[model samples]
Target: MPSSELFLIALATVLALPWLIWRLGRTDAWAPLVVVQILTGIALGPGLFGAAFPEIHRTVLNEEVIAMLGGVASWGVILFVWIAGTELDLSQAWRERRDSTVTAGLAMLGPLVLGGVVGMGLLWHAPGWMGPSASSWQFVAAIGMACSVTALPILILFMERLEILRKSLGQRVLRYASLDDLAIWGLLALILVDLERLGKQAAFLGLFFLATVILRRALPRLNPQDRWFLSLVWLALCALAADWAGLHYMVGAFLAGAVLEADWLDQQRLDRLREMLLLVMMPVFFLYTGLRTEWQLGGASVFAAAAALLLAGVGGKLLGLRLAGRILDWPPGQARLIGWLLQTKALIMIIFANILLDRAVISAETFTALLLMAAASTMLTIPMAQRAMKHFQDQSPEPSKLQSQR
Candidate 1:
């Protein structure tokens, strides 16, 4: 078949299958369309889709078609992460430092410790879990970080869907997630540190800091429209530079937006941009990621591994939040509900695991396990939070609900 025809087939399949399942299945109460899209991506991957229909997979995802999808997926993820970084409200986190610090600290630490232990056990029992490039410590830390991740973007989407994004409890959840977001990236940067390229990474950081200073001063003066374009330019530069420096372009894309003020961009426009990207481009990334999945460890083994990681991730999060509630004297049940929200992980965790895979810090089997855990974790978020979010909404003032809509 012609390259154009094959590309169209691949593209249409990527876009149509997930939406069709989401619409026809009507699994919104348990699984959002995005989660369905993710699962669909996996089904379309080599592990299942290729295994089931090898000829169709090859015909549709030829070299040229795969390359095209890869290019789009790369940019889609970079822009998505950039916007996530831009949305971070560090000032608000600092203002609510006492509560945020205790909650976020415990939330991350608990998972990190438990996940690290799990990583070690996996390494012992399952030799293929670690990548060739990864040292024992790096593999442990990377897996631990994966367990600790709270996908802020997915959390925001779920909160909005639950009509809690603007509520006081919702705002508080955002704060905790925001702080954890900063920590998550910082930890990733640390894990990605190559001693051989230490000097280059340091140079990238110094230059990035200088460039950030100039942009902060210059961006505020620009008309809103220009700032939008310029932000993309900055995003491109940072992504390219970071990839060059061995920190990975995604890291650079994140730093590019993390340094900028979110208020500088029009919030409404930002929201729309995010929605459109998720609607149009992000599925391409998910499909590409799914293409990387391999279940060489066998289906039962992979599922078992995923269950272990899920236990560490979800169990540790709830445990951590319960401890935080005790320390802060929260009302009963608050910690459990918040823990469920914090358990939301999809894109960011996948992004993190992708970095580990790209750097050969973890093997495909491990990546497959983490991927399964992310899908399962994300699937649980809406259903688990629905009851609590509704209760809170009923108690919330009418003005607060209106504010959330805005």
Candidate 2:
């Protein structure tokens, strides 16, 4: 069969299977459609579906077809990350600097510490977990950073689903997550620093700073339609330059968006664009991610590693938020609620692990484990957050009562 025909079949499968499962199984209460899509991606990978239907898998996802699908997936994820960076409400985070900083700091640090410990253990006892190209520190730091990531876009989706996106509590959570988002990207840049390409990386940063200044100034003068077009042009340019510098195109994609003000675009349009991207483009990226999964270390070992990472990621997030709550004098149960919500790691952590894999900073087994951990962590968020929110609402005084008291 022709590669083009196989590619079409593969694309159809990627787009259809996840929606069917999510819709039919009614998994939204515990697992969002995105989580279900991620799981489906894993299931469709060489680990499961490939194992079950080797002949069909080989025929449909041959090298040429996989490469074609990869191109589409790469752009989808890049645009998604760019949108995430653009939507970051840094101004609001600055307005709530003290509280946001403390919460975001602890939230990240706790996971970093715990996950680094886990990384150290993996290095010490199971050296196979580290990629051949990775130095000891690179492997450990990548794992720690992966644990600390909070997917700001995914968090926004969850908050919107929970009906708190425009509420004060949700706004506060966004502030914290936004701050962490900055830190997460910064740490990734640090991890990806290539000594060999030091000059090119430095040059890319300088050029990027200059380009950002020019673009920000120019964007305001253009009509909205032109502004959107120009932004894409900028995204492509930055992505190309970053890849040339060995910093990775996704990093470039993110930085391209981060400098822009959200108010520059129509808020509704931006939201709709994000929704459309999730509905259309991102599932391919999810499927591509699953295709990379390797279980050569044995299924038992992979699951065990994933479980350890999940515990570390979830436990550290809650502990950190609890400390922040005490210090900030948050109302009862608020910290726990916020913690569970913020612990949700789907897209960003997966992207982070992907970069590690791309850089050979982590083994494919480690990447697979991180992928599992991210999916499980995200799956836990909605149910656990609902329970905590219920307890919180029960303890708080009604708005009407407070108004009457006033």
Model 2 lDDT per residue over 1-406, tens place: 8999998898898889888988899989988899988988888899899999999988888899989989998998999888888877777777778998999999999999899988998888688899988899989999889989999888988987987766667777888888889898999999899899999999999999999999989999999999899989999999999999998999999999888876677666777888898998889998899999999989999998899899889999999999999999988999999999998899989988888999899999999999999999999999999999888853332233111000
**Cα lDDT tens digits for candidate 1, 42-151:** 88999999999999998898888899999999999998899889878877787889999999999999899999999999899878999999999999999999999998
**Candidate 2 lDDT:** 0.88
Query: Mind sharing the TM-score for model 1?
Result: 0.96
In order, candidate lDDTs are: 0.88, 0.88
Candidate 2 regions with alpha-carbon error over 4 angstroms: 394-406
lDDT of 1 at 53: 97
